[model samples]
Target: MIYFLRNVDDKITQTNFRKALTIGEISGNVLMDLSVMADEVIGPLLCNPENQKGWPKIVQNDMKRHVNELRNLMHQLKGEMSSQIMLPMPEGVENIYHAEARLKESDSEDVDLYLKTNIEGAIIKWAQQIYDLLQEDSYIAFKRTKFPLPISDIEFYTHRLRNLEGIYSQLRDPRVKRMAHYLESTRSVYLACFKSMLTNVVAALLREVCNLVIQQCTNSVDPMSIFQGDADEQLIKLRKAMGVLNHFIDTYEMNRDKVHTFFPPGVMPVRWSFDFDRVFMRFNTFMKRLKMIDNIVEATVEILKLEKVEFSGLRGKILSTECIKVLEEYTLIYQNLGNITYDPADPEDTRFLSDYDKHMAVLEDVDRRLASLFSQGLDECHDLEHFFKFFQIIGDLYHRPIIKNELKPKVAKLLDFMHSNLDAVKEIFDEEMAKLNPKGVERPMVDPYLPPYDMNRLNRAISWYNAIREGSHETEVALIEKEISAIDHLLGRGVEELTWNDDFTEWMAEVYAAINTLQERVLTAQNNVRRGLSNIAAWGDKPLHNRKDNPEKLELLAVNERHPRLVARRNKILQSHAEFLHILKDNYKLFFNIKEDEESDDEEEELEEVDESTMDEDERLARAQKLQAIMEQWEAKRIAREERERERAEIAQAKFERREARRLKREAKEAEKRERQARRDEG
Candidate 1:
């Protein structure tokens, strides 16, 4: 009955076949609808015959066959609709089978279109399904395919096309042959576009990587500047670029066999040709550059070591200006090189962990050289003048940590030495004064009077201190004052068991006060002596009767009677005064010339001396005039000496006052700064 139905369907007239075509299309739709219902509802119902025993086996079988026939008709109708060729037919014929038969008698265009619509449509549909499977997830193409799957999309499509070609080979239809050709050509075009896009993307990434490598080589400074961020940033960027290139290579390698096939013969030797090898080659180049930088740093450190050796002999020797300049230049270069940080874990870094010591040695050398220069400066210092110059040089290098740490203690030691010498000198002066004055003898309280012993003692002490003060620079003086102030602060902490040596500030202050007291006493003594001389001259001019009634005058006359004990006391006073003046002349030559002026005048006066009895009258008068002129010259010299002493004393007093004022002001400023700092810390 199915064969009879097929014959009737094929033999239908044009009008009748047209009606049959409409009915067939409607019937195919109805069967499709039923096939869905059967799977969703009817098949489940039939699974248990007891549930729907009304439907017999024959009835179910017939319905299944009808569904299959309807599916075949739908496939045929799809092929006919896709055809661009109009299949020739007899007049008024509408049957699709007859139209197809007429089309078989046509030329290649019609044959080609008919075969493409009929067979190639199915091939295209199958190729599209494979394409969709390969691109299931856009981000991960074909990554989750089953075992034995095609390696890439193009390969998978090629395999499916081969199977379709084999199936169509059995048919003699030229249309089927053309459809196979069309499908193969379309697959080739699709694969070409895909490979081109992949190549472009890979080429662009390679270019970017190459550019980054160039930038790393050209723009980066030496490794020393890496710590400042420039070289390090460039290296990090290079590393990231390398990472991207590595990822692309990994992706390409995964599908290498399939994707590489897209390239025509003789175009690429293999998948690992220019594209793959170039990336790794550039990576190797970057690694070599990094190693080169490491070597450069190591060599720089070695050069610095050589410089250190050259300056090593300069230790303990007096530093000339040229020596200082050389040391300064070496230190600056060492500092610039010392800033480099090495990473031992990096493959390209040739600097091993053990080599870090070599780098540190360079830094140590800088410290050693600076410290040696400071030590040499100190060793060469002898007097206050030299000490001031040395201290200024040290101050210039004070900004270096090594100089501050190493040289400050040396400076402190020098100060201790000076302080000890000062104490010894002061002690000698005191002992001499004690010897001159008897055990129980008190200093006289009379106005404007200084004992001869006290004057001699003061003269020695003043000369010593004045020499020190005159030789020192102002800044050195200030440094001494700062040290003294620090000692005072420590003592003020109220620590009871302090050593005398630690109380240097107090000792220095006491010594200064003594000198000031002696200066005042000297001035007072000068005034008192001048007043006494004036009184004696006035008394000597008065009449004897006027002086005889005055008890004060009688006492003064007895004291000046040239009695033996009074005469001895007067001679002792004169001897002590002469000895004190001699000490001033010897020790304080920078300030005094008393002995020199006296000796010169005395020699000149002796030359002018002559006896009046041994010469004529005219020669005797000339000799008297010469003697008067010599006495006047002596008087003039004595007056100039006194004026010079007075001027020196005044200048010393003014200098002391200015130094004291500055010290007080500096102390006040320091206290205020400390207070502000404390307040800020509290807040």
Candidate 2:
């Protein structure tokens, strides 16, 4: 180290280096004394001066070796010193921010100054990283890292801050000033983040306490059932929340100083918008109000002269009908309480409110809950039974003296719907009674064996009246519920109930007598037809026993002119059967669920090819008239089709004749031209 030092001193003291250091550069040779520029000096051997010294070869070789060693040592010293300017960053990691170097008080002034000069680039890079990260994460990253800060020691506080203190440059050049600009901006951002985090901590506590208040109020459950929260768990949550808040306040007081020490003067606020006192006061107010509600509830039980009240929730919510009863009693008290005697002389004594005012306040709060619940509840009522019951319970409460005036319109609205349904049921009952199928001369035959009344429609009305009968709604609503039920018992029994009525029984008896007479006649006719159809094949009809006889369609019997009496007997049987079927069709109408096929007559006649010779005059004349009309229609259609075809042929012939004339004329023109050309050629 001494040898390197001696050589560096020796080289700087050379004549040319001395001249450059003292005399720098001179323009016009006048400012040689004032110029600050320095020029580099060349060695004599490189310049090859004319009068340079000529040393021995061994001596020159020794000087060159030591000079090369001195140069290498100086270069190594520069590399070592420059690397310490920034902290030793982990490999592959960008040197954004890290632990500050352990700068010692014993560091020489020049050493400190040298390090300060080299630190500008590192500080600039770190500031740029903070700026970009803050912008990218919208300062959320900084808040997570540095805000709501822990009670860390001074060592943790000092991390990444050494370069920003007083060590960095404050120059006008952008390179140096740019570092200061960014760092100053970053400090402002950090200060804001610290304030926001501290304030947010208190805000979160206040919000939690406010939520406890709401949960306490939302615990009410009554006829309206505005809130149905679990009571026991809510009570536990209230105490737990208070305990947590007390513990948080104690912890904040304990760490108050530590927090201030962690963030020095500019990074922390002296006074904040939110504080420990404000959060604690909000919690304290909630507890006080809770006690007030307790007092009001106890007073209410005493005033109503009721049995020992059992509390279900913080709010005066009860599960049974007595809750509504208490509200009813409270209504009476509320009216008397309105005549409060305030001190006349001490008008400023408005500080004390009577128990009546407190009760009214609670009821007003409940009134708001009812209004909200009713608006949503009435819209959800779909069933008639439920609508009446709901109105009986909740609507009656709403119509109380205290709550009535405010909720009168809603009560009237629901009653309108109720009256409309009642009117509709009455209408349905009247319409269905009119369908009794009265025993008159015309249209007396109802669906046979079915009830003369529309039992389904009558039962619908009966069931509706039953539904409305259960609940005691406030409004004066009466219906024919009892009368409708009696009518139902009489008429809606079953289809067989129709015979119990005298008019219907008499009509049914007459129908039965007529049907019995028709049945006797039909049996006689069928028996006669069957008896005549029997062929005495063993002896009476010996020809029918012939081996060659075929019964295919009975045509062989018809062809046997020798059996005229046989044909005549068969014809009489067929005619008699036809008369029997006609009698059945003309005399009776039945309760068939559907109509007979409308084309049955046409189809039967189509199949009635009963050897047209057998058809009587009436059937034969009708058939002949029908067949004649059909033939006339077909002949007229055929004539029209022939006329259309004839017209089309005439048009086609005219076209053909025109085409032939044009062809003949063109052929004549071609022949004449050919002859004229032949004559010209001969010439």
Kindly list the per-residue Cα lDDT of model 1 for residues 1-683, writing each as its tens digit: 01112334465786676544444223445545554555456545544456646778887555544443344444434434542111111111122333344445553223334333334334344344334433433224345554433356545444434433333232224543333344344343334333333343344345445545444544544343542333335456445544654565576567775777778888853453335544455555555555544443433333333222221233433355435455566546545544657633243455543455564555466556757765766665555556665665444445456667877776765776688779988887776566565555654233344322233543565575464457545653453454335434543532442222232344345455645543343444444455555645553454333223365654534333446655655565676567556544443432222356655754664653556578998887877787788779878888987998899899778756755665676677779999999999999
How much lDDT does each candidate structure score? 0.49, 0.43
Tens-digit lDDT string for candidate 2 (601-655): 2233332356788889998899889888766766665686688689979966874
- Cα distance off (Å), candidate 2, residue 17: 35
Instruction: Return the TM-score for each candidate structure.
Output: 0.18, 0.17
Kindly report which residue stretches of model 2 are placed more than 4 angstroms away from their true locations once superposed: 1-228, 257-683
